[model samples]
Target: MVRRARPVLSSLGPVTLDRTGVEPLHRQLYRALRQAVIEGRLRPGERLPPTRALADEWGLSRNTVVTAYDTLLAEGYITGKVGAGSFVASALPDAPPQGGPGRGDARRGVGLSRRGVALAAVGGDMRDPSGRPFALGTPDLNAFPFAVWAQLLARSWRVAGRGLAVDPDPLGHPPLRAAIAGYLRAVRAVRCEADQVVIVSGAQQGLSLVAQLLLDPGDSVWVENPGWPGNRAALLGAGARLVPVPLDHEGIDVEEGVRRGGDARLALVTPSHQFPLGVTMSLRRRLQLLDWAAARDAWIVEDDYDSEFRYAGPPLAALQGLDGAGRVLYVGSFSKALFPALRLGYVVVPPDLVGAVRAARRHFDGGTSIVPQAALHRFMADGHFAAHLRAMRALYADKRAGFLRTLDRCFAGLGRAEAGEAGLHALVHLPEDRPDRTLSALAKRVGLTVPALSDYYTASERRAAGEEPVGNGLMLGFAAHEAEALDRAARELADLAAAMA
Candidate 1:
């Protein structure tokens, strides 16, 4: 074979080219030169050696060097003189000198608003990670047919084409919305057309959207006392003052909410299965709430979270379905069913408010991913979702039974299973004196997750009055874990509680 041409030596800054690298030779050269210029390693207006000479030095073709030089010139990294070699552009790219904030301008960490600071405080740390056994609010992800979901997702890309790839409707994918409407009608008795359902990232986003549209700054919004932290934060972020109403066994005490904030513009209540406490709103209570809302010209935000896997009697009818006055804005999430990462949920709004809700969604989040929406449409159409829910209900029922049995075996007093063993978690009552915080901390130390019920309440002092929060209890999750695993963990938790006692 003929010997390779010897490289002509040229004076330039160090640029060791790796021939074995996956990056193109021209790109590597371009990057090296760019870095040198940006870092000021190459002084401004410094002339570069002829490409022909540099090419030989780097063991690359003359064309490769020419391409790099051309790119640099085109991108303003360097200038080319017809008769002369490439020169580093006089004005180079570099940050302002380090000193004051603007002098070293960073994109972030600069003059954050009060809202930003408040949001920043909202939590990065999780109470339990690695899907801690008996953790509340977590679904049994193993039960979800992820492989089937993946196939459907891939199929959506192939079949749906460019539309699926582009920015979808801020409201939602029409097909998915239609499917959701039908599902709601058949199962939850929530009557609504496809247009009435605005797809959101989750229940949280749905709540936020409602808050943004309906709630003005300083507007009052009633929420459950021992309610979800996300709901509280979302309302607070929207500048809505919370009216923390006490909950009875009949769910949110409407009279108490009225007494606290009767003039409140909005009421965010979880009627089907109250969070932390797990009380289903009585029919009378539901009517009372509806009447109160209608009388005050106030809106009710019905968060129907975790009504799917109810181990008790038939699933309770959604407040939205029963609503004759169109006062309730119904919210539900798939996090408890499919998985939290999916981040797909919907808010069924009345006909009048749909446009405003959709507009708010556009400003908040342009739209949810079309691929998942399409996949969900397919999942619902194929009966896989229903089948999965059926299987999970049975599985969760057994797990709930195991947890209750553990409570009976290991603990003294009777611990009531909320809504007669509905949802993913159960409420185990502790003595009034046993500080729930101490119990929660002690449980956490043993690698067990038992969320204190009283912690859900927001007040100056510890306790809530009038059978509210129903007092000291542990909100133990039972659905995420398998029956045997839950049994072991619950027993171990009981042992920890006993030892502490």
Candidate 2:
């Protein structure tokens, strides 16, 4: 393993850099040295400390010390002669600009790049305050088998050998891929081979990778009106014009989506269970979407997030299973099942796209780390994964029941809970007059965050023309907390609704 070199920072210098701070240590040291030189604190012609000496004195890496000195030399702030140490340059290159771009107040803050600006404008703002009770879109982390996981992780690392040294397969760890392929076949009834599964950091990364691989600029993409925010943001970032397809009781309206997005090249759908408003896609609807994608030469990115924890009804096969033409790209994540921090996800593509996706992954994502992949493989191989899933399903079933009951007791008829028999969250529809955005903010003030359903609707003009009112609801998550905590959160939501009403 390559360990980061330590820094040898001292209080004696004009500037002290925090090792843990987000700013790079080299950048911080460079700024400090530059400022000190410009202010004449370090006299002209004075020799700076040797890189070795400074590194030893401040517990910093010699390279960090050298880089800082090198930057100063390159910028004319310092000079060096062969066999002589570096010294502050007697004559500087140019005077600091008095009034240039980002002068005065602008200079006080760091500016973001164009890409950074765009991402920030549409980024998610999730908070896990107050021990993360009822936190949406997160698994029940407290129930994870950390001890068993640690054992598996240690074993994988010890036996790593070549895996630790060699460049990883961009597709994934082989055994882990095999494990996932087996699980998908036996459990989800998805048709895939181990070689076709491409492991990723998470479904979010998988979504972005799929877009990068397939989408073109200005290409139309069909998205659910009130859909997964991550997918919507990613599609927008990929330069796809998002046409919001409204949802019906069966799932995303396939006919409506195609009617609106006739020229669309891609579609993102959560078919097993719709997000926010939980509803399984009917077979006819699935087939219709499949037909549309196959006929139009478009790709369907099937996000089967949290498909393992079904609490009621018959099991539903993955949309990819029924996809005969290989148009569906199935994506899933361990974030919702295992834990968010695990950051493990997989994408099962068609046989034809496997090599293309795998070859592209080396250049783009470069696959996920091998350690976690190996550990997860062992976790599944040992039957711990299945056992964990069973326990979590029961736990969430109770949490969901308790949550709905509390809502019934506290604020009956005020909000409607829309949830399928599975998944981590449920959507509570608020009255039309209520600003779901404001209600979400009010809930967050007390450390309980419920996402506003309206924020998921991107097509303003289309929604206005629709017969049904624009989506106004609270996307409540019940899987993360215990019964007591869920009840408390429900009471809080009720109180907020009453007060706001």
Candidate 3:
């Protein structure tokens, strides 16, 4: 047998070893050394002390130190050579400076651009509350045909040829676009051809695309006061100045929008069932908005989200249907109808504006994934989409009725439901003296997320528009949760409110 030469081991810098419960000694050593590398305690290319020396110093087994060093080596925190021991990586991954002078300032967003800062200012602490009781803008996932969707998804790949293998259309899958156009025309009465329907990731993306493609910096755009906060972010990020137009029993106050920004470049409205308030836009206002866009050489963006769940008769005709001037760009999402994770929505643009929107969307994300687009087309083509909507409409109608009854029983004389004839949520207006914001926070502590109505408004906008804010109320969603769960949550919420009151 050949005689083996023992490799020389060099001494490393001193480090404290943690022998705390549950955590392995090797992992403890790994964390300390990795932190040292990250914090520049161990400078780049500095050789680490030999594992045996560290093991001996810290009363740890030699194997523990070796394992720790091995982990560091794997994570690129250190490098090892046959005889040279380990050295700190010459080039390390970016990590925030920690526990040193000026470290706090470095992480305080001091270097953000003006737009970045502006975007940050407009941001809210909005968290995903899917499957949570009374969570808005989400559908009943338990009722969705997920198994059917899975089958369709599998079929999209299994039975398909090169169509599924290649990149999707910059606009969308042609069949899906045509299907959307046909569906919109038949159901929502939106006027468009297959070419005019562009599939976007979601309605929010469609709004952002419209903002970037149409409006210029400082261009005034009409936005509803207490409207969707997301619309504000998208438009503001695109450098458009927002003119907050108030809403009434009718949809967006058309005359008021013109007063605020008559020459506005665009008007974004949730006309079909105005979000939160859930009011359907009067036909007169729809006509007035369309005429305003026509006369002022402007455009209108109609967000028709969640219209399919209308509790009354067939959902009202889309505001886009009345736009004879082809001035309306209709945005709708399937998140409320199907599920949020699908991330599927469509924009029906004017026939003339189709090319520009498609070009802009091409650069935004090339296009939404072809797999879902193809699957959705098949879903629509086979009539499953309509059938699902029918079932959900009936189910939600029952839930809506049960929810209203529960609210009446729980919040009698204390609050009244102000939601319109349709949509997933009820706007319960509390006595003005009962602060909804305080109540909303209190509800959150108990695992509830009832949104305060006042949080939706821009106070200055409400003041400037000479309109009183929607005032102390909570938007309680009823679609995602079953009637029993919603009733329980509503009763719990009422108890909390009564205690505070």
In terms of lDDT, which candidate is strongest? Answer: 3
Encode model 3's per-residue lDDT on 1-501: one tens digit a residue.
Answer: 222122222322454444555557787678778777776778888888888886776667999988788666644577766788888888773222222223223544656654454455563633345467787877788899888999999998888847778877888899999999999999988888999998999998988888898889889988887777777888888888888888898979998877777889999898888866787888888888888889998988999888888876788888888878888899999888888889999988888887887778777789888899888989999999999999999998888888899999999978997567778889889996677866775566567877778767764544546666665799888888877899889899999779766
TM-score of each: 0.74, 0.75, 0.77
Q: Which parts of model 3 are misplaced by more than 4 Å?
A: 1-108, 123-127, 461-467
Task: Give the Å error, residue 69, model 3.
Answer: 50
If both were scored by lDDT, which would come out higher, candidate 1 or candidate 3? 3
Which number leads on TM-score?
3
lDDT of 1 by residue, 1-501 (tens): 222333232333556666766657788778777767767777788888888777766667999998788666644567665678778878752222111223222443567554444444332222354677757677878778999999999998889878887788999999999999999998899979999998888888888888888888889888888778778878878877777888888988888888878999999998888887778899999999999888888999999988898877878789988888999999999988899889999999999998787677778779887788999999999999999999999888877777777777767552444435478777778775565655665565456777777657764233423443346778777767776777777678777666544
Specify the poorest-scoring 10-residue window by lDDT in model 3: 2-11
Model 1, C-alpha of 479: deviation from truth (Å): 1.4
Tell me the RMSD of model 2 versus the true structure.
17.2
Clashing pairs in 2: 6-60, 7-59, 7-60, 8-58, 8-59, 8-60, 9-58
Query: In terms of TM-score, how similar is model 2 to the real structure?
Result: 0.75
| C-alpha lDDT score of every prediction, in listed order | 0.76, 0.77, 0.79
